[model samples]
Target: MENMLVTRFGHAAVLVETEDARVLLDPGVFSVDEVFELERLDAIVVTHQHPDHLDRSRADALLARNRGALLLADPQTVEQLGAPWRAHRDGDRATFGSTTIAAVGELHAEIAPQLPRVSNVGVLVRSETGPTIFHPGDSYATVPADVDVLALPLSAPWAKVSETIAFAQQVAPAIAFPIHDRTISDAAYDIYWNHVANFGGVADLRRLGQTEATQV
Candidate 1:
């Protein structure tokens, strides 16, 4: 099998490339401007409707650039975004070139009891010639089997260090890396990464620099 290459465009946005496919995950507001310049994507996946995870302002242009890419989003996002985006609910699977994407989980993590809950889905992406990676959008509820690389969420209003450690331990991925971290400062990142490194229980924990690609 060929290796899979993953590039982080900041926060939760990632460009995952395999031998036969190139897929972008969560091209959100926090993502770098370079995300819009990417081309030849086999698919664009949005885990939820949150602007931080799906930038509505740049969505049109990005779609225009990758006109052949499949657009997949959570149920509510599909309802909100309308045409061209298909709802990828829990248990639903889609194939893009040689890559297979499976949607898992349903609701975003609770921010507060007063806030309305929105739909969310964690995606599991695998290719016949590459590693299996899991990107858990905003929730740590679904723990898929046989995950090689985990795109772990490092910070959020709805996340805690303890919970982050627990989630990584539960998934037990061979390798893990941080995502959803644009909100915190560099000092805070050091603190959080320290804790996860000590207790996340994964064999390897990688810190991906913005816009840099790493092969697995």
Candidate 2:
């Protein structure tokens, strides 16, 4: 079994590569040109329908390039693609060979539901990677009690330092990685230590910046 290699492409975009194939999530900021190194993806898993999460035009272009590849996403994302795609709901699992990915429903933007917005979801990817990783897309809180590696969304529109810290304290993952952060801030760094850091306890809290990669 090979470790699941994740290459953060800034924003919510990430390229998760396994030995069998590569899968991308929420790649919106840069053009496909920037991801020249990411080649021949087997699937592209999307979390929601937000522009920042999915570039409609870029996704259509890439979908054409890898037309045969699986484009598994929420209903809105699949509807936007206007192509043959797999729409995943909560508890739905996609198994490719020995790999497995589970879709868990989530709240969108932590805002009022009456705002007439679409749905959101979190992804629990469990392969032969270092651990079962959870990328909570843009969600600031979740119900799952256990997490191995948490790719937490920080510095979002509605997320405060207090909410993020409280979330981490509740889940208490084995390791926590800061994500969805537009820019690194000292204040945000302080929030992690003052709140999420389990140095005195057990969890290994890690912060993966725009360019860093954790060796699995």
User: What tens digits encode model 2's per-residue C-alpha lDDT throughout 1-216?
Assistant: 237676667767767666666777776653234443455878778888877777776666677667667778887767766657778788888877656678887557655655655767778777754456777777754557556667777667667767777777666677667677764476656655555554313267666656556643
* TM-scores, one per candidate: 0.97, 0.82
At residue 114, what lDDT does model 2 achieve?
A: 58
lDDT of 1 by residue, 1-216 (tens): 338999999899998888877889999999999998888998999999998998899878899999999999999999988889999999999986777999999999999999998999999999887789999999988899989999999999988899999999999998888899899898677998989999999988889877878888
The candidate that wins on lDDT is: 1
lDDT of each: 0.91, 0.68
**What stretches of model 1 exceed 4 Å from their correct place?**
none
The most accurate candidate by TM-score is 1
